[model samples]
Target: MEYILFQKDDFTEKNYIARHEEGSKDDYDITIKGRATISHGGRELTIVNVSVEDVGLYGCRISYFEEHQNQYYHKASQKVFLDVKVPPPEWRSAPILRRYNQVTDTIYDGDIVNLTCRVPGGNPLSQLTWSGCPNGSQTDLSSSTEAVVQLQFVASSSHHGSVCTCTALQKYASPQERSSNVTLLIAHPPTLDIMASPALPWFATGGNATVNATLNCTATGGYPPATLSWVCKENSTQNGTEGPSLLSVFPYVGVDDDKMVCVCEARNSYTAVKGRVFKTIQLDAEYHPQLELTALPGNMIKEHDSVRLMCSGHGNPSNITYRWEHGEWSMAGSNQTILNLNRTDTGNYSCTGASNSSRYGQLITVQYLPITVNYLDVQIAILETNLTEGDNVTLECQTEGVPSLYDFKDWNFQSYLMNDTQLLNGTRGKILHMENINYMESGTYTCVVNNTALVRHGSKLLPILHSPKLHPYRQASQQVVAPVNGNVTLSLYIVANPEPKPADFVWTKVKPDNASRNVSELASSAGLVSNLTIGNVRESDYGEYCCEVANGIGEKLKVCFNVSAQGPPLAPTGLHEIPGRTTAISTQVQWVSAFSGGLTQVFVVEYKDEAGEIWETSASDINDTGEGKNVTHKIDNLTPATAYNIRVKAKNSYNGGSYSVYSDVISIAMKGILFYNLLNENLSL
Candidate 1:
């Protein structure tokens, strides 16, 4: 038998060998790498049995022919061994339990929460269970060690001291548990209640009152505190801080009752809770008696006027009673007092205001008196006299009154006063006799009576007569005077009733119809008068003359006088030759003057011529003296001149009512001269 073991790079092998009798079949057994092996032929190797170790190296030997040819290598075999190992089973940590806690969690009632428990570091994980107050009030969980247990219901006062717990379970190690406790505390704030006294009761006069009240409040348990306050409803102020907790308010001394409200408020620090309470207090005010007085037309009343007085007052539930002095009077209602007075009622008066509770009164006074005036009467007089130029005149005034009259006293009449005097007498009845009655003391006068009530009321007009009338007389022709040249003087006499009286004398011309002309006034003594000279007298001065006398009071009287001129008649010059067939002719005649009254009369013209020497022609008369002045004439009915002499003569009544002088003879040629008569011709020249 032979056995071998060998080593390879990554394996080992074992071989076993045996030699048998040459003729018998050889048998071999071997094990390799966990298998068993066997062999039989000498020169050939075969696996008869195998084992696990016979896998790698092998050897075999056999002999049959050629025995002893070299006893070589009979058989060969191989063996191997195998080794195996298993790993230990896997390991892991179980779940851990987590506990959560809440310290000052502030929650209101009816709030839900979930508490968690976690288990870490466990193998194969673990399961979870919730414990503590189960009763279906907490949530359940499974399949996980980290468990969340939920408190589904709210926390309440009944839930106080309760806990929510979670537990974790694993296949290894100890069980884990976690817990949280909940405290259900309700935070309710306080409520306030208020009350008041005097409670709707009526208060009368002199009634005393007292008030009593209380404030009640309640608060629930909470972490922080609350506050309560009392206040007045009207002002909304905190009563305890601003003023006294209890207050008393009074009405005016005489007022009625009223109602008032008081309030209480409550508040908390942690919760928004506020509460209020209210109460009402009733109060009645008392009254005292008072008085008011009045008078009609209060002061400074007029004379003979009347007035009224009144007094009134009021008290608690009603007005007070009124009483008047100096009469039995009592009144009710708002009008409690009264009085009616005239001038006779001008005196002091008193009134009283009274009630069942109180009384008061007052006093007053009044007065009366007369009417007045202030003036006098005055008189003025004008003495009667001739009111001629340069005459002395006097005027006086006299006033009638007990006291002397004032300076403003006035005397009035138809005329005004000229001088200041108490007694007035003058001409024209405006004179006062001061022992002598003269011509200046005659006229109308008046005396005026005056006073505050009467003005310029009394009057008297008197007449004074101390004047004479004088007049002049005249006797002359009735025609308008013709133009003449000379100085002429007429004489007349003045007659008057009062001899040697101061008078106004005047001389004037008069016509036959008695109308005067050329008036001239002069101041003189009344009597017969002489010539009133007229220088350079003309034909126009040949009219009648008269004299007049006046004393400024009555109608004037007059006397007439005759005046004449003595002068020769002069031949008329500037006569143009008359033309044949002329209807009328006018010629101008002029002459020179001789005596003072020349040409103061009428004139006559006559003419005769040869071949027809005829008796003196019919008279052609011109009434006026040719006193060296020009005068106009119109001669009619004359034939053409045939040589003629014309004669003219002056005439006057002073010369025995005849011709006074003859003019010189004048010759005129009538041949070849046309004679035109004014009655048969147009004389427009």
Candidate 2:
């Protein structure tokens, strides 16, 4: 028998695997190749250390080929195919567990990872599996390459950046496996926070304008450290090194907006475009209080009308207060005030609104005329008191003022009937009783009442219908004194039949300079009375003023008044005495000129010692140093160590009214250091 190796029924001349015939054997050299073997049994051929070049179809054939056929046919052959493959370069390092999650080269919590591992082509298809997955976590295959194992895992934070590994196992003469691991590098967008570093107050009250307002922005929690940036309204930019950035600014107070808005951006480089966040906040800006004024009831801020003022100031810490001041009067209310309107209410009113640290104020002047009748007519007139033949109808007049004269010395009241030319008695009370009434008794009646203490007066009129014989009585005004350039009134009080015409009022003035002026043009007529008003009274006006009043049918009545100066030129007020500046042995005195009698003034300062010796020196005789309306004098070389009483009075060269009543006595204690020192030296010697 012969054993031969054949290749696909064709014989090769040089290649030999194994051959044996009848106890004689030949083998492929195993020492050089190390993977091929041939047994001397001549039955088998094997090759080790497989390579690509060893793949082919082989056949074992017998050359006898059924010898009976003897036709030289090739022997019957059976064939088999041999394959050799290595483990595909160790699976290419398990495919580098990356290429997802922004290429961070890692897996993170809540990440869905698809990891592929290749076992490579080997003697049999390799096996693939995974490990390090959380307990009860199901694994699924996303897809795979030929000879590669792929697995997808849904991760959770509970995975906690643990190892995730995919392994490949090759089925060879010895099972070999390889694994690749991925440690997660979690990425997150920055959690951003922005705030005013220190809150700003609502106003700049008590604080300088250079106060720094800072805004802070921060970011944290990302794969790479986050950076912060800021943009402010003042065209400014700020940057931060790591997570937090700060921008500082100064507010312009009232010149800036009431609020400040700032924005900050935070992002991480590793997270690319998706890892960004922003935050914003508004802060209160300091400013001054803004004041507003409001009035109610109308613009007619007049006497006897209800008027109110409201002042408001707007600011932070909203508890603001308001004060309304008018000269000597003031009201305190947070926002509003109402004051009673009086004759004295016409003046500048200041409204001030204040906060804890700031204040705003404004002033307004209120002016209005009093609501009183300037005409000579009374407030009430009841006409048509009918009195005919023998019908006595008593006419009464009602007035507002309580009578302070007429019957009682201090009770002032009067009633009269004006007829033809004389004043007829109207029963002397508020009521007029007419007996045996006739057309001749009908006339106009006047009632006047007054209260001098309160400076109030009231009067009324009643017209009796008929043609009565009228009688008139004359009453002259009393003497009056007024300030220079002030007003004075004199009248011829009367009762007459017909209303006194303007021609009936005659007034004249004789000046102290012996000049005369007719003043009837300044006269006004009202019923039975006529008045002359002297305006712009001058020093020359201090003299006799006379008036002659007559109805067309009555006897003329005449009266006169004596006008005087406000006071003697030396009348002094606000008087005070002090020790002389140079020496306490004498005294210095000062006084304000209350009235200078419309002329230049000199003061008389009198001092009396306890010994009944009196000394007098005029302001003109001493120091005449003072501003207008003030008189100051110093008396030197007086008796020392003596108690003295000092008083002051005023006099004028232009008018020598007696010197005014003396000022209150001011007792002075004299200090004579020179006298005391001399006495001490004498005693010592």
Candidate 3:
């Protein structure tokens, strides 16, 4: 018998097992190693310990002999059909893992990992499966007896040290399974994290002397361990430029770490081959910001000039602030501020730049540049000093010259023909102190200042022994005609050789009520024209105003004028007369008081009978008390049963003050026959 297998695809034939019942004794390869096998069936073919060569279409042939007519002949039977198919895949060997097409058990994270498993031979075509792989993997079984399984996956941190298994089994056969496992080379990038070694209390306060920021970095993923690196950067420079640089190698924080940004980085690669993964984080080590101040127009600000200032510095935190400080004023901005420089702004200025952990300051001075005048400005406000012989006068002599050198400036006073007296001689500044000044010291005061090889002088005329003249508010009379509840002015002028300085003018107002106020300044000047402004005057403010001026030479010279705040007084009302005994003519009449004209006065009461008498009897009541009071008096010998009416008038010290005007009155009065029937009966008895 001969067993032959036919390739299903090509119908090619191959002899598998052969046996002879009767044949020559030269065939010796049968049943070698017991691998070539057969089972009990004349036509059935079975193989044990199968290999890839065993699977195909199989057939069995048998030969027989028969004797006929005394002669023996040989006959051959037809080939019987037998087919062999592959079973489910069974692992013949171990699985292989590859990274980047290289055989490696260590696959790094972010790498595509490849896995392959193959079972060479099985009947009925084995199905292949992967144990530790994504679902829906494909099995390759195109060949009748060989099964191939391949899988591809991306390596991740979770895949580290995990096992990848390829399994094969024949479902129809005894549930015997074969499997191969490969420890996955899950190479992953380094696990990266950083922290301040010594925790910090506060990260921002400009510069904190206590802050020493050291960043610790760690890497934890991938097969072979990962390495750490660091980069250093300065937020900015003194010129406000970003300084970005890296360190030569990984190292601990150095001395220059202050105001330096240390970036921690972690690196790793698949197969531990070359650098691939890079993770970085920045750490800030705070310190005081270096502060500098620079002014526009170069620091020496002239009066009425506008100056701008800028502050620049560097710190660990890139976010910085700029503030300008002069005295108690501070402004916040990016790095610049502006100021309108004036005489009051001459002082030391400080600019502060602040950062997270520290602050820095810069100082500079601002003042008026030296004024360049060809000659000294001997400015005497008024030629009439508005002073007297005994007045202590301060003669001001101002000029433009180098005050630091005495040769630049000098002061002298001289009369018409008297010899010049050196008053002030100083290099720093020039002024004259004329104590107990007399007429002899009155003339022209001169300031001599050297102007670059030229001796130039400025003169101011001075006067002595003059009094201040007074003038009311542009009115013919020396009285200020002030309106009620309105403002008024009592101005005065002086005709002295030198005008009085603002400090020399004094004024006092003696109110009609003698109510005085604290000394107040009401005088001002506009060149040679000087006057006092009286504001918000009322009728109660009506009184004499005395302006006194004395140059310490004679008694204080005083000028007096009058100002009034007068208006109409309210009308008096509620007037009535009380009746007495019918036999008696005595009666009492009373009425309310009206406007006092801002003064203590009296009320004159006049009444007459309705019989057309013009003026019957009139009486007077001294209104020595204040206004708003009732006045009553006794009238003797009054005839009863007579109709009468009374009227009143009020006056103030102000000339032509207010009196009752028609019906602009808020009052009432009662004058009628008094009820005296009982009194008349008693009188009759």
lDDT of 1 by residue, 40-61 (tens): 4233343334322233443433
Candidate 3: residue 163 Cα off by (Å): 0.9
What RMSD value applies to candidate 1?
29.9
For candidate 3, the C-alpha RMSD (Å) to the true structure equals 23.3
Candidate 1 least-lDDT 10 residues:
364-373
Return the lDDT, model 2, position 11: 49
Error of 2 at 1 (Å): 15
Better of 1 and 3 by lDDT: 3
Cα TM-score per model:
0.23, 0.38, 0.38
Candidate 2: which stretches are off by over 4 Å? 1-86, 90-115, 123-187, 195-203, 208-210, 221-227, 231-244, 251-259, 267-276, 284-289, 297-300, 319-340, 347-685
Q: Candidate 3 overall Cα lDDT vs. reference?
A: 0.51
In order, what lDDT does every prediction score? 0.41, 0.54, 0.51
Winner by TM-score between candidate 2 and candidate 1:
2
Model 1 misplaced stretches (Cα beyond 4 Å): 1-104, 109-145, 152-178, 191-208, 220-223, 234-263, 272-685
| TM-score, cand. 1 | 0.23
lDDT of 2 by residue, 76-187 (tens): 3577887655554545563334334434455444567665555434444555666885443333333322455456666554564567676666645243666677664554
